[model samples]
Target: MSRFSLVRSAPAPTPAALAAPPPVAPPAARVESKPKSPARDAGLDLRLRLHAKLIEELDLAKLDKLDEAELRRQVLGQVTEFARIERMALNARELEALGASIYDEMVGLGPIEPLLKDDSINDILINGPYQVYIERRGELELTPIRFRDNDHLLRIVNRIVAAVGRRIDESQPMVDARLPDGSRVNAAIPPVAIDGCSVSIRKFSKKPLTLEKLVEFGAMTQSMSDFLYGAVRSRVSTVISGGTGSGKTTLLNALSSAISEGERLITIEDAAELQLQQPHVVRMETRPPNIEGKGEIRQRELVKNALRMRPDRVILGEVRSEEAFDMLQAMNTGHEGSMATIHSNNPREAISRLEQMVAMGGLNIGADAVRHQIAAAVGLVVQVMRLSDGKRKVTHVTEITGMEGQVVQMQDIFVFNRTHTGPDGEVFGEFRATGLRPRCLDEMIRRGIPYDTANFDPSKVLG
Candidate 1:
């Protein structure tokens, strides 16, 4: 500084020079931009573009490789980049949150969630995710709940099958399971499904349908309910018949509610859907095989076991197979008031189906023996049907009048007469009583029970 001052003594160093060179302008408060690398920027752009295209295609097969959280992150990032390029005014944080919520909703919801929520939907059919169908009032209709692809649909199907301890692969391509809500589920995949993966769920009520509810719904007249209650009280073995979705199990449950609370009831079924209110009721269900193909139990096995339980009545959910033989035997041998359901169009067909199922047991019994057992076991057959107008009604109530020759003679004590249909597409029918006067009624009267023949007058009741 002395040398500099000597050299420029003429001007004498200015106060500015002495004052730290005017503070050097404080470096202009520079904002440092993140250094951009051409190679890294290009690589990131390439990755984002590829991921955007993949997401646009909704390719579940490849998306499945990523975990749900990672997929959500990537999707949100791509969406943000897209909005930025389009000069849109979307809040980045809000868009990311929406994407995460949508992903969770689509992934977490089960395939049957929509159908279960729809009150009008009585049944749900999943012929893969792209081919969903539903039944409303006994009619089937297709829906549109498609998956991203076959892989996604299969993933859901596999999840359901695995949860139920069933397998639906190329080898065991078909499976029958039940939902947690007691809905019946059947699934098929790959070679068996043919049309990708398929699933069918027959939804059941979470609550048992009572007799009073059935009467309120006009499924049967109150007189019919009273008579059926009388029949149940009289210990008359009865059978209920109906086609699919005709409320067979619903009717069976209602009838079981009429059973005396003192009686020890034993109920057997393939899937255990019956809801009897009696405290003494014993419920039994069949078991499917494990993955090792061991520990299988059938309805017939349960029925055979129930015989040893000393049941006052054996209630079979539905006699669809050889279990009919054991059920019929139980009913014939002192198990009065025993009841079961069968798939049939009418009373005669119900008898025929029972005989055929009894023969399916692989026994050496002749058709005559089967008929005799059925006639003796089943004293009453009440056939219900879901009409075209979506009303369930008891179409026929027949009393088995014992065996005549090789056939079971049945007398129709009550019949449904279609009066007409109202403008609202409602069916109006009259449940008329036939004055045949069942032979079993006299026995009920003799047991000090009060059942008057005057109640059978159709003119007084069917107005």
Candidate 2:
């Protein structure tokens, strides 16, 4: 048996030590000395006897050896026996209701319950019953909550997997699921996790990130926002790239808000996170297979289908797989100004990562061909980063200048320069213009859009 069983079965404290009462008489005398009323006598005959019997049967040995299904079966059987012996009145529905209450009280709330109620806690990570963590306001911290034990945690894991129509056992032992609120969940048990069962939940926010909020947080200046608005309106295909938890999605959402309302937009994601204000928006999400291991719809498949929908722009939540190829093809065709995000350190590395992803699509194309496609497709790469001082900023806004030989060329149109740092480690950076306006800005001016070169000149504003 496990050590938990030994702890649970430890001897109880003596009555004198537990209370300030006098020494009790012998058990038989104490029982006979009690003043009995009709209600007390009847209640004792049923509930007290049932409680004693249950305590005897629920000893540590029986609990440690039983699987979840067997334990549940035993619990139901005991409930039925107690009801029948007491001649209590209950229908099937009432009995099931009682069973659920007892189960919750005995076993504890399952994995996702605590996470659902916590608005400040953005993420919940479970590394078995003994170790759990949560992310709050971009920082990860450990939590004191635990499952009943490893077996209890496993039972909750199994319920989640089964609800998603997936399976996780020794063979698979890993799965991804989404909660009813659309929070993303990934689980890996035993052998695979190596540190007992593990679960990671990325919480969903019902209210999407907005540009107004970004400005209030000092993530970017209003001039930068105005420039991006012009870029998106002029159909400059942009990619927002950043490291994990670096506000990539938030920036992407803010940028997409600049898209003209007349155009139809289609967004594809593993879990839908984008909040577009336009009325003509269609959202598509990927799906895992059923228990039969069929009917799975992947991101690549959705990307291809989005192409056929005659969309004005295609928005992908994140490009981590071979779907980057189709996304590039769509952009290279007529879908200019289409936007998505990728994981990369800087704008230059974002292009390299896109090229690598295109190669993974099983295409036999040369690197030169891939670079050409990327250059012609992606017009701008906006790199966002969260610095050590807990400030998120747009580190680089780079424009693709086209391909030179086999290499893709990019020019930084806007860059953040750290002007000063105080003794408290707070950074002060200025977003400065590089004097190289995008080639498409001329097109925007020709299309009757007003242009003020003075606003684009950072020196004029700084002075």
Candidate 3:
């Protein structure tokens, strides 16, 4: 090896060897710490421990067999004894509230019962056991309420489905049913729900809102309500279209009240919720399949059967499936004054949905044929929308004239023009006339319904 090789072969002087180790410093002081844990509440613990003791002391199985009155008495007795023994630190008012909450959990929805009893809650949306939201006065608010665990939430969902005599599990994980108070419930669980159970409840008031009441509530103008009153009385085939929860069914119910009480009326719904007050009305609800997957009745079947019942007016709670074709056919074939709701953002989409639904009904026809049928059968399209401010307004009230070329022509007689949103997130707009006269005024005159041409003029916009 060369001297250069010897020089290279020498162990390279290491930086750590050449440089003295940094002077050792004193160790930093150790700070004592504890494992992080969630905050604890004495009230929650007292109630929970009391509930646990009551479960053991009382026979829940026998309690289930007892009637509501006896059950309440037994539960109250158990709570009274448990409170006396535990000597709970809570005051009397707090103790009573705890007892009531326990009772609600036993006989009603547990954490959700309070929300259900809330009159101002329009909707309850549960993402899981921990995330509960409510739609109150048209705005969403996250609530601190939660289920004890995922299993607790699942149990409540199962209970709700069981009460309605429907079943949802891994095999069939979705269900739509109505509560005893007529609130619509939709639920889904895993594997359909990856996280946990999800539920949406759309609440209905016990006393339905009327057209005049809706006007008073700022949902629509008096002039618009007047036009709708005239339209319904004149036997017009109307379709209310909008996004989900946009007040479609509410509008449908209000319009049905305008139908002459003398006419024999029939209503078909997946769930019987139309609270029409007509004396001669017959209500029909569809049924799901049995456990054996038989004995199912669809809305299309009901629509076809309703025609044979010789009804003067047929109201469909909604036309969602192939039933749209039958509903349209009914509208044309002497079923005047018929009404149904469709999901669409605007009037034109409503027309297109009708055609699509016709195709869905196994009609072997061209698009033009379906469009033509929609043009003839459907007369007025009232578009309702839930605005950004949580207020529902009549966004568009359009009239469908005959087809211009291949497309069905629509004229917007009234429209809510939203030009801007306010700084506070409120929608700023006004209902304006589209400067087009409605053709239905001629029908009003022919039918002799109470209406004025001045009310249906082109220039009368309402805010």
Candidate 4:
């Protein structure tokens, strides 16, 4: 018999009980009744019990060998049997929901599984066991879902990292992991995260966003898109700069579609979130140290190793450290179409950040030489930003026109001019091209990559 027992239906009424008369009420008196305490959710408690029973009955050792379909079938069957044995009153819909919840807790990430399955949610932020928040349509809203406690929340985190052959605990209080569908996961616990275990999941779109889709979404104008397509096709090395949640990676992915299929591509990242559609591509991810605090592999090492892989282009997911020096070397060498993303406010700040990163490499090069290297290596700086209204736009399309002494000369080709905010809290901006034509237009024309000089006309509002 199972250890758990449920309240069974009352025994059929006996004949004597049916014959007995109703009891008389006592005389009226001012007897006070205490206020009832708040009741807990009975459904959550039921699901938790069912989850525990399911885990106890299943042969977990052979779970890995079973296909998802078969495992799901077995889980549903077992759940139905368990409910029937316990005499729990559950309808078809309720039974199915119970089965799904049990399955999620058994093989998925527990309480957050439903949130992860919701395509509408862009981000899942867990503040603690009691608080969960999701980002939808660019605004954050709290969800009713929660863990049982801190231990429950930590178990979910452990499951996530373990799937990717990683671990998280007090010794290594933070970790970066990815879901099966390529969503990025970052977790911190205990001493590192003061309140409780916190997890941030950045969900990627099921369908990869292309340049055309971005245009339709008003992320950029048709003219801006055309210019970027031409720039990428002409093998102009570019850098995408943006703040957090600013669609930098999305823009980078869209622009990468412009790359020729014939060229081999190599991508390096901290968590391997890029979804390149090219057949000839190699992806690399950085590794954190093991329990012994050894065997840590950083992005810089991967950047150096990618050089020997014979790539037509090297794509860094994001340059945050000394890898900027090696990335510059790749772009300055034969890898002309290489691209990467950076965290910055604007084009000017992006260049300055790159300079600082190169210096972080502990190289003997002077500041002037570093500026020249940046100017020669990066041809275009695509600045993206998330507006107050939660919409993302390409704020600047800047071209590095080489160096004049210590300064790297850059000119704005396309700019987003924010005029006003709408009554609905929407940001109203027009994407316009400056009157001065970009110097890269000549390079694009030389490469026969289909030029459109009209895109640079000052009178034109591109988007």
Using TM-score as the measure, the top candidate is 4
Candidate 2's error at 387, in angstroms?
1.8
lDDT of 1 by residue, 24-73 (tens): 12222323441121222332232333333433445455566877667766
Worst 10 residues of 1 by lDDT: 1-10
- Alpha-carbon runs more than 4 Å astray in model 2: 1-115, 155-167, 289-295, 419-427, 446-451, 458-463
Ranking by TM-score: 4, 3, 1, 2
lDDT of each: 0.73, 0.75, 0.80, 0.86
Q: lDDT (0-100) at residue 204 of candidate 1?
A: 77
Model 3: colliding residue pairs: none
RMSD of 4: 8.3
Winner of 1 and 3 under TM-score: 3
Ranking by lDDT: 4, 3, 2, 1
**Each candidate's TM vs. the true structure?**
0.73, 0.71, 0.85, 0.91
Estimate, for each residue in 1-463, the C-alpha lDDT of model 4 and write its tens digit. 2322321233433335333343435423422451122244566666776676556556677788888877777777767776766676899888888888888988898888988889999999998677789999899999878776577799889999998889998899999999988899999998887667899999999777999999998989999999999999899999999999999989988998899899999999999889887889999999999999999999999999999999999999999999999999999999998999999999999999999999998999999999999999999999999999988899999999999978999999999999999999999989898877888888889988886778788886885
lDDT of 1 at 176: 75
TM-score of 1: 0.73
Error of 3 at 34 (Å): 26
Poorly placed runs, candidate 3 (over 4 Å): 1-73, 457-460
